[model samples]
Every structure is written in structure tokens, then in C-alpha cells.
Target: MSHFNDFNNPQVAALPGHLKQFIVDQHYEHYTPIDHAVWRYVMRQNYSYLKDVAYYPYIPGLTKAGLTIERIPDLQEMNNALAKIGWGAVTVDGFIPPAAFMEYQAYRVLVIAADIRQLKHIEYTPAPDIIHESAGHAPIIADKDYHEYLSYFGSIGAKAMFSAQDFELYEAIRALSILKEMPDADEEEIKKADELVTYRQENMGEPSEMALLSRLHWWTVEYGLIGTLDQPKIYGAGLLSSIGESSSCMNPEVEKLWYTIDALKYSYDITKPQPQLFVTPTFQNLINVLEEFANTMSFRRGGAYGLTKAVESKNTCTAVYSSGLQVSGTITEFKVDKHDNPYFIKTTGPTILAVDNKLLKGHGKDHHKDGFSSPVGKLKNADLPLEDLSADQLKDLGIIVGVQAKLDFESGVTVNGTVKNILSSTEKIQLITFTNCTVTDKKGHILFDPSWGGYDMAVGEKIVSVFCGAADKEAFEEIVYKSKTETHHADYDWKTRELHKLYQQVRNCRLKQGDYGFLGNVWQKLQHDHHDDWLCALEILEMLEHEHIEPALTAEIRQFLGQKATDEPELKKLISDGFYLIAHPVEQNLVF
Candidate 1:
């Protein structure tokens, strides 16, 4: 039996089996003290800088979202806080498929990646880590209109039809993200993974529904700005979480465009900073753009075009007939009529017939183990569409059970057999089973032979809708998008573990644990053994300067950091930022 821990969150518990498959244990104990330190540094910096520029009051929003500047958030704590707002959170291993991610959002559950970025990449990491997921995404959701926009986008995104190439691209990106985040990852391997991502992205022909929707999401949810283009404030999670980009995005070089359907025309590279951003006047405008785009998706516009998209997906999808019957399978081929309407569709492998997203009794994949095929258009001589016909209407056409019938369709397809069963749901004809049946098309090419056993023909005036995944995913046993690549968890070396201990010591000292003397000892160890470390010493200096206890020790630590900053150009800004935040405390912008 598979076990899933929902962390006692109602929204998480309500998730379907297929979606639950993606949920993993948060294992809050696995977070090292150093990891907490990294979280603290990012949160502190974000609060310091984002207070003026962030869309919402950054510090107060963090509290509302169950976060703090002192530590990495515990998942249960986050869930409890989010529950008040009718939301929940869960941890995933790493990058999940975009479709699955969107579905989680639709369920009002945040999928957080529990890992924190390495200390070396403290400023910004391409990987999706705790800082990016919880700090960047969870806090901003406190805004009602913004959260509503997110949930709305999720609902639309969950139904978007994704192509096979889209899956390939997602996998490539996942692999690349995981590799880049791994501290010991090889440069050559990273290069190869990046190339694969580029290859998949470039090769994906005419973007699928999911691809286009992802573009909109990237612009509005991940890297969007709010207010006027000239004086916009940061709202996007990507900007909120990345201390490096949040400051740089304000530069005039990062082109800002008015958010609209036009944003879909722009693609994004996740590995680098966004070259451009979209600005929305209000959060409701974001939903307007999403609604406008959702109208164009295959799920909303069902026909030959929709079926063609489903077939191209090469994944399990469902096509809904006008009769309200649903056929779920991997659509392999679809034949169009002279007017370009789909007349017949075929699934090559296991198929299930459903109505209103419930599987039909005795018509599951077990019964139709091979495939299913049927004509879609109206009969040549029928007064009404097949589904609209009543019992009397069907008997007039000789389509009743236990009757021999030869049915001809307007598209020149014929079904010749003995009608064994006629299935109807909610007064609409849905399925017709035939024994010893032979089906043929206009050119006399046999569609189905008697040797293939009973033929179950789906009844519909036409295929009215087609969308991604099974109509009833649990019933279909569809596990959509399980990635093979796993995130690399670092096994800390003894020396690294010692460094974490020193950081932990300082954290304890800052909590007023009467361990002020430990600072001098920790500073001595850093100078003698860990010459390159700067953040730990910086924290120590902050404590000393605050208390004014050891002027000589404070001056010495400050001199060390200044020298280190000058020696390492990359560490210069981080050291200075630490200095600046200490001197210039950001006022607590908290909301009640």
C-alpha cells in the first residue's frame, strides 16, 4: 500500500490519488543549521530591500504566510498558517512537470521544494529551492486578488493540452535544474544538460496549449511587475525571491511591457535573469489575460483541431462527444470529413468510455484492451443527431439491441453488424456495441474486422471537446509525468559539518544565550582554519556592534570582512549588503 502524509491539511487531503503521487515528506529535521542560516540571510535581505519595492508589505506578508526571517519554514507550520487562508503546502523532490504543478495550484496547495540553495549561490540560484518556492511564492499570496488570479490560472492550466515535445522539454529542464543545483555536478554534464534543454525547446513544433499557458504564467506569476511601467513595484515570485535580480530588475535595461495576451509571444530562459518583464495595472487584469488565453485552448474549443492536438500529444487524453460521453486513451489517428470536420477517431491501445468523468460499467480498459474506434458525425439519413434520438427515434433507425443493422454516416463510413447493446446516460445515447461487425470507410478500406471481437462504437454527433489527460484520472490509473531525474542531496563533509556548527553557535549567541565569549573563539577558528568564510564573521560583527561589548573584537572582525570583500570581488556586494542592513535597519512593514 502506498502511504501519503497530508500533514493534516484539508486541501492536501482532498487531492486525488494521481496528484497525491507527487507529494513527498517534508522531513523538516533534514535541514541543517547552515541551511537555516541561508534561509535567514535571504529573508533578511529580501525584507531589507523588498520593503520599499515589493507589491505587498514584505515582512507582514511573511508572517501571514507562516514564514520568518530567522529560519526555514516548517511545512506543518506553513500549512497551519496557509489553512487560515484556505490554502496548504507540500514538499516535492525537485522540479515536477508543469502540468502537475499547475494542478496542485488548482487544488490551492503550494508545492514547495524543501532544499535551500547552496551558500555559494546565496545571492541567486537557478534551481527552485525553499527560498524561491515559499519565500517568493507563499508570501505574495496573502493578497486576495493575487491569490485568486493564481487559483484561476491553475484551473485553466490544469486542462491545457500538452504535446509530447512539451513533456520532453519539461524533462530536459528538470534534469538541467537538478544538475545545476548539485554542488558536485560536473561542468561537462551541466553543459550537456543545458544543450538538451535548448534542443527540446527549439524543436517543439507549434507550441501546445500548455506551452503557451506557461509563457503567460512565466510573465505574470513568476516575473511580473505591478503598477505603471515606469514606476512598477515587484510582484512576481522570481523577483521577490532572487535578491540579485530584485535590485537589478529596477534598471532601465530590463524592458518592461504592459501585461496582456501579447506576453504569450515571449519565451523565457529559466537559467538566466529575465531580459524583460510584464507590468499589470491590477491583479484582476492578470486574470483577464488568462481568461482571454484560456478561451483559445483546446479544452475550450473542441473539434478536429482539438483532436489533432490530442493525437499530437501522444499521451493519455480525453475527447468529449456532444452526447456527453468521454473517450480516454492515447488518440492515434483522426479522419476528417470533406468540410474538415473529424468524422472518425482511433485510440491505438487501452481505451475507456466515460460520461461526466465516470467510467462506464463493463466498458473499462479491461474490456477494450486493444483499442476503440468509432465514427463521429451524424448518420446520412437521420432526422436528428444520434445522441438526441429517443428510444422511438432509435428504433425507427433500427439501432436497437438484438437487431441486425447497417448504419451509414454522412461522411461515407458504414457500420454493418448485429446490435448487441445500446447504452444511454441521462437520456443521451452514448455507446453502441456490435457483434460480428465489419466497419468500412468511403474508399472501401476496412476500419474494423469481425475477427477483432465485439466492436464498441462511441455515439456522438461530433467530438465537441478534447483536453489533456483522462476524464477520470483515478479511474484511468493515469500517473501523469513521473520524472526519472532526482535532485542530488549533498552528504556534508566533516569540515563542512564543523562550519555549520560554528554558524549554529553564532545563531544561539544572537538569541541571547549568554554565549558572547563564543564569538571570539568562533572568529579565531575562522581566521586559523576557515580563512575564506565571511558570512559567519559578518553575523558575529552584527552582534558585537549591536551590543557594543567588544570594540577591539568588532573592529578586528570588520577589518577581516572588509579585507575579504576586497580580495573576493563576488563577495564584495554581499558583505557590503550585510554591513548596510546592519547600519540601516529596515522598518517593519507589517499588516494587521
Candidate 2:
């Protein structure tokens, strides 16, 4: 029987020159027959399944490292093999703190354990035994980039633990590590343990936090896989350690996305197999990712003041605000249908202020007359009918009908130009210009109807709508003129040109006469005719008259142009001419 030693002392002697040397110096014993058998069994089972599924780099790494399914590896021998690749494994008693772990890796030592659990205990070992620590984690340490990443993780982890604000994130990482080692632990028990950790931290003046940890662990360790577009593979320890996760993570259902540092830092899911895995095109790409992460997360530094404050404030305010809001009223009833839209918190409260559809100004004001009345008032009431009722009466009797104002802002920007001129205008528009748009109030509601026929309006327009509607045209025109006066015309012209190019592509594809293949052929011809200058082709088509084109060909072109004109009217017009040219053989011959 082995006793777990306390490896937390900062004054402990530095880890030995190499992991293997440390193991030998510490008098770490060799594995017993049972230990060797367990190692072989795990190695065989995991490798046999992983040989095909493991990252291509890992396949040779295991073989080149001489890690086989025969027996437990001798630490010295394994270290000798690893030494060629600038890595070695050191045996330890059990789990180590983040600081110690970092220190070991910072010195190029990969930590391992020297004992295996009994067969009966294998399924439920609360802590990592030798087999899990050494065989499961060691071989991959031989890879250079991976080894560096591990060292980086250690450094980051150690720094994170010292901060008061990052305590919750730290706990979440620890909890994940604990959970990974003890997969058999009940979900309720795990939740209870998390709660306990959170409680203890809060009592000690540490705010409980874990969402970021969950995201980091999920993307970097659990179910993480990386490779080039041509050859994607697994490198994450969680996937490397387990056969099933490795295979499942690469499935089509698990979406693969480009690896951006911001994406890794902010968003990731840990519960299910990841919906997306970042695919790095090369080892250099991995380095780039690390560099980006270091730069963005300030990984080289100890802690970020702004991030710390945000996390701390969010943690404290969420609990306080949720409690207060819940007391205002419980949602007694709700209704949502195909076209009716969903209604929230329909309840028998004090009748507040109610208004009819006419009160709302916009296109659909008369079509739908749905609204609500909430008795909550703040410092300012924006032109609402609040004068009739007294303060006391207002609290008891205020009703809001039609679409309620969920979020109100002073102004916004709109990109307005003819479809032909949009691209040129885009380049000319100032970056500061705000778009005036209204969003739908319901969940997943559209803020603005980009598909609306009159979406392209003047710039600097202040749009006011009940739901996805614009303010009056006169008001919009005034704002647009003001914005244009302040903005450079060249920038707007550049934007217009860019929009023109996009519209050209959509119009070309849409204005095709037949199937995709047939349309593609026609597009090829048009491209060839205009020396591949789509803009010139559109201009030529727009110049042709309907009488100059055949009816059948014109119909086909019109159908195609219809789809393209939605956002790119210039393309639509071009395709329309192409249809006419195709329909009228005499005109086509004359043009040719």
C-alpha cells in the first residue's frame, strides 16, 4: 500500500534534472506483475482503438517512443527513449498542485506515478494511479509542441491560482481534472462537490466561478483535436487518454472551426462532445495560436485587471439581480405560436398603461395590436402617456399595447445607395457611421428586415419601428443628409463599388436559364464575353431592351434576376438582359 504525500510545500526541493532521474533518485520502485499487466491491458486497449483514430503525429510518437502493449514501461528506459526528444517522465506519489506541476514542466519534467490500482478499484479510482498517470499521459509528452503547451498550461494555471478573482475559474479547472480522473463519480455527487468548493471559496471571500474553466478545458483538453485542413487529428489529453472520445470528437456532428484565440478563450462547451474543434493547419499554426493566446489573454503576465473585475462583478451582481427580479412577479402564463409570436409573463398584476396599435408608428402598426403594461418606471419617460396618472396611480394602472420598447437607443447608421453604387459607397463611408435598424422584440427576433424591399436607404438615418420597421421618411432623410455632409463622399463611393461587385455575383448565378450546370455554363459564357469582367457584362445586359430579346429567354432571365435583385439590383438587371438576349436569336446574333 502506498500513502499519498503532500506535494504542496513551496520549499520542497526542485524537481530533478530530468523526470527519469528524479524517479530514480526518489527510489521510485518498478511496477509489480499486476501493475505491468494493467499497463499492458490499458495500453493495448487504448492503442488498438486509437491507432486509426489518434492524431497522425501521436501514432508514430507512441511507436517511436517504444511504448508497446507488452508490459509496464521502466521509468529509466522510457526516459532514455524520451531524452532523444528533449523530454523525460518523473514518478510521483499522486496528484500535484498547479504550482508544483508547472515548476516540473518549466524544468522539462513530465510527472508520472509509480503504482497501479487494484483490479476491483480500477473503475472507481478517485485519484490517478501509476497506470493512468504514466501510460495515459506520458508518451504524448515526447512531442515538442505538445510538451511546450503543457508547460504553458502549468505556468498559466499556477498564475491563475494566485488571483482572488480567478479562484472560481481555478476551481472549475480543478473540478474538471478531478472529474476526468473519476469518471464513475455520480453527477449529483460531482455537483455537490462543486457546490462545496464554491461555498468554501465564498466563505473565504472568494467569488465562485467556473464557466470559463469549463470552456477552456473543453476546447484544450476534453474532445479537442487539431490538424491541417487536409489532415485533422487529435492532440488534446482527454481525447488522447480515452479511445471513445478521440473517435467521437472527429465525427461529422462535431463541427470543426478555425482556431482563433478569442474563440478558445470565450466560447466552448464541456458537457457534450464539442460541437466544434479548432483545426490548425501546421505546427507553426499551433505556435501562432499560442502566441495569440498569450498576447490576448496576457498569459505571460500574472492576471488581467479588467478581466478580473468583470468576472468578479458578474458573479456578485448575477445573484443579487436575479433575486430582486424574481420577486417582481412570477411568469404565470405564456403563449407562442407559428405567427402569433411568443408572449412572456402574462399575469394578473395591477393594470398599468395600455395603448392600441395606432399608438405604434410604422408599417404594421394597424395590422397587429398587441402590447403590454409594466409598472416599472425610471428617471425618464420618452414621450409616453404618463401625465394622466399620478405616481401612485401609475404604479397600479399603466398599460402598454402594440410592440413594447425593449431597448431604445438615440441613433444608428444605415448603408444607403443604389445596388449599383453600394460597393463604391462602402469604401467611402466613415467607420463611425451608425446604422439605424429596429430588431424584433421576441427571442431570435430579427433586428431589421434586411429582406424588406426598401432596406437600402440614405445614410445616418434614425429608424424608429415597433418591430423591424423604419421611422418616417422625412426624419430618415434629414439624418441621412446630416451624416453624408459629415462623411467623405469618396468613402461612400468605395462602399458602393464593393456592393456592386457582390450584387453582380448574385445576379449572375440567379439569372441562369436552367439547372446549376446550365446556369454555370451561361455564366462562363458571360464571363468569357466580357473578359471575365462581371461589371461590364451587367452594364451590357442592362442596356438591352425587352423587344430586342425573346420572351422565353427573357422569362428565364427574369426568374434568375429576381433572386439576385434582393440585395443586388444591378446584378438582377444584368441577368434580365442576358435572358432577353438568349430568348431572341436575331438579337443574340446581332449582338454577337
Candidate 3:
């Protein structure tokens, strides 16, 4: 692979002042008013929802980095804010090629687009626009560890270009990783895709290798994860750059998995909402993982074999067995076939099921019955000993059982049984219960209903609460009461007078722009509905009412408001309570 100089090392001088100045010189014309509004809307909505779910580091980093629900920041201004923590933003057009993207990261400059999609087009935008790239990713860039990990990622991508074997391995691992996460991904298809990747790597030239590397880049860097001990936070540019994905990753329904290099390299699925996310203990851990992989370039040649082993160990593939059946023909065209079929039975791992022919035609189920059909009579465990065979003979017998084998000895009596049952006669179910939990059967019908007071619930069963009516005082107390005293105030205390000043400033701004109809009549609605906090509403209205307001001006306004909101207690409370009073009508109108 081609080696590139690491731009993040201290030996590389800090960004030139002129380059920084050039980015600052870019005007508000670069971003349309609609873009600013979208930025404001998205930042506001996402921040509110993320307050409880986001990692503590992200919450403060966002605020401290000066991101607010008011405007799309100038690249230069954003850089200035991030420079405090040794990070900054760079402007780029939509998506960059993998090589180019890596080059940008190598420089410690995250490329953020400057445009934004309209509210209606937000979710379905075809590419990364300014709002998605900058707002979604820039704030987190301020974190030191995250920044370093990205730098390493760039280095890996750059080097992978040199070796065809390494590139193919990278692609196969990435494809497997992403496919495992996608909901629509077919297991058989995934197996096929992995097999194809392996085959191509073993046979292809540089062009094919490069193509696979590109695919890997798309899946991992643009759409991968940074798992930490506390949580699996998003680091991939795709997730970091998209508002929907950022919030979606934190939902309770999204399953979380422990972080391991092997799990990421061998079993990740990308096309669907991940059933599980791997969390890393720290950014250093992330760096360590990548670094270990990076140093193992020589060993990476055995990618297919390693993946097969991993798949087998994880039990990700199906198992099949058959007996007393003339199961001829090699396990031809097996999934994960590196080159030609190497004796289908000998091929271990997920593809092991392809060895037996009887199992291929729906062997075990009873076909005549409504459920399943079986062609052979059932085999009992006690019947096996009477056959008394050698160890190798018994081994073959085991394989037959796995394939759902039917035995026909001297007599014409036939017997069939599952290897799973033969190995273990009975299954055990463990039950766990929690206080105040409700229990439901496999069909979802309630088996045990907990009273309003509370009740015990069985393990391995679904529990859902039914609120028959408005909660009573006792119920409210049970839910809300805490053992320790809680402080219901901002972490940093602010003077009441300062908050009032901010409120007045915002209110005045809104009043000045109350006549303009842009932003879906935001100013007009604020005048009518938020008469009480008209001043603060007016401020927001004025800031957004103009068609060509400069980003710098917007940044100033946001900084002032952020400071006042932090310094003034009463004003902060008021702003927090009714920040959207004027924008409510606009929101309602837009929702429909």
C-alpha cells in the first residue's frame, strides 16, 4: 500500500494562518437563509432529545463548542471554537473519494459542507450537505481521542491501497460487518457476497482490489462506529454527519454489542438498523484496535481462513446432517468457497451445512402434518448403542445425525432423529423475575398482570404496562420520588438580572421582525401567541427574518444569547420553558 505522511503529528506545523484566514473570508452567501433555518431547526430538535441520551462529553462539547439552534456557522468561526480543543472544520463539496477523504483527516481538518436541505427534503437527501456534515460531526471533533482515532483511520485507508491481498481482506471484512447489521440482508446472500469477495481477492488485479477498498471505506469510515466502555458512541462520518442516524443510534430498541476487533471484522451487517452495537471502553481502545489491525498487514493475507474460523466459532452458519441416504456429489458451490470446492464436508464454519444432500430437501419435518413432514420414522437414543461401531464409524454416525439421517439396518425398519435432541435429551428454560413487572406468554397474551402498586414478573417474558387512567398522587410519587435531594438548576449559576436582559434582547429582535413572513410566519405567530415572552421570541424572529443575514452576525447573536442564558438564571429558566413559544405555530404548520 502507498504510505502517506501523517499530518496529525506534532512535527507537522499547525494549520497555516493564511489557510485559516481563507476559510474565514468565505461569506454568508455560501449558505442560503433556508440552510441556516434548517440548521437551527435540526440542532434545536436533536439537542433537546439528546440531552438525556447523549454521552455527557458530547452534551458539554456541543454547548462549549458554540453550536446552537440558531444558525449555520461559518467554517472559520466553527474552527475558532474548535481550536480551543485542538480541532477545526474544513469545507468540502458533498462526498469525497476515499483517498481524498483520508488526506483531509490526515491534516486534522474535518471537511464540513456549508449547505443545508429544505425541511421537506431533510430525510431523503441523496448526499451529505453542509448541515449534515458540519453540525452532526464538528462538535464531537473537539474531543481529543475521537480526533486521534480518525487520524489513524485515514492512515489505514491510505496504506490499504498498496497491497491487493490486504485490500481484498479489508473489503470482505467490511462487507461482512455491514451486512450483519442490515435488517434486509439475507443470510444466504451475505454468505454469497463474502464468498465472492474472497474469490475476487484470490483472483483479481489492482483495479478490483481498489474497488473493494472503496467499498470498505464506505462501510467503515463513513458508516462505522466508535465503541467505548461507557457506550458505543457514533464516530463514522455517515452517522456523525446525519441527524437521523445520530439520534436513532441511541434508541433503546437498538441492540448494543460489546466491542471486539474480531466481531467488527467478521460479523457486522451494514444495510439494516444494527441489531447490536459494539461499545468500546475509550477512544484509546479504539485506536488500539485499529493499530493492532494495521500492524498485522502481513498476517491479514489469511483473511478468508480467519473469517471462516470466526464464523464457525460464533455459530453464525447453519448445521446439517443426514443418514442411510446415498448423499453423493461434493458440496459444490458452497458459500465461502475461496476457490474450487475443497471437499464440501471438510469445509468448516458456517458453510458446513452444505456437505450433506439429504438435509437439502427439507429432511426432518413431517411433511403430511400441517407443521412439518418427516420421510423417516423417529430414532430413539437407546437404539444407537445396539449398532456398536468404531470411533471413526461413530463419527460418521454423528455426521449422519447432524444431517437428519434415516437408518435402515438389516430389517426394513427406518429411523430418523435430530442430532440436537440426540445430544441433549431435554431442554431447560431459566426464569427470572423483577418486582413490579408484568409477564406475557410467547403469544404476547398477558399471563400475569401487575397491579398499580407493583408485582413480580417472570424471566424471559415480555412486560408491558397499561395505564387505565390518569396516574394518582401515590403512583406519581412512586415514579418520581428520589432518595437524595436534587438540585433543579443549571450547573453554573447565573444572575437573575442577566437572564432578564437576554429575554428582552430576544424579545426585541422578534418584535422588529414581526412583520416579515419568512420561516412560515414565525414572527407573526410569535407576536400573537408569545405575548408574554415577546422580547425573546422577537430576538429569534429578527435573527431569522432577514434574507441575507451574515453567518458572522448570526454567530454573534448566538454567542450573546448563549452567554446571557448561562449567566442569567431567571432568563435562562424562561428561555428554557418557552423558547419555542413563538415558533410553535410554524412548527405545527410544517408538521402537517
Q: What is the C-alpha RMSD of each candidate to the true structure, in Å?
A: 1.7, 34.7, 25.0
Candidate 1 pairs with clashing backbones: none
Task: Give the alpha carbon lDDT tens digit for every residue of 264-316 in model 1.
Answer: 89988887888999999999999888988988888888898899888888988
TM-score for candidate 3: 0.41
Q: TM-scores across all candidates?
A: 0.97, 0.40, 0.41
Error of 1 at 270 (Å): 1.1
Maximum-TM-score candidate? 1
lDDT of 2 at 266: 46
lDDT of 1 at 433: 90
Query: Cα lDDT of all candidates, in order?
Result: 0.88, 0.39, 0.41
lDDT of 3 by residue, 313-418 (tens): 2211121212212111111121222242111222121121111122322222221111110111112332442223333554565523334443332222333333
What is the lDDT, from 0 to 100, of the residue 100 in candidate 2? Answer: 43
> lDDT score, residue 274, model 1?
86
Q: 1-592, model 2: which lDDT tens digit per residue? A: 1332223322123343222222323243333333443454345445555656566544456654546554555655666666676665666544443334555665665666455554334322434455555555665666666677766655443322233443443455355435544526578867876666555444544322223333444465434556664457766655665434566666677777766565554454233445667765554565555555444331222112222322333211000010011101111232323333222222222111111211112322222123111111111333332222333442343212221123221221112212321111222210111123233433444434435332211111111111101112121111110101110011224543444443344344434431323333444454444232333333234323322444444344444455665556544433443454334322221111
Q: In model 2, state the lDDT of residue 182.
A: 50
* Strongest candidate by lDDT: 1
Q: Global CA lDDT of candidate 1, please?
A: 0.88
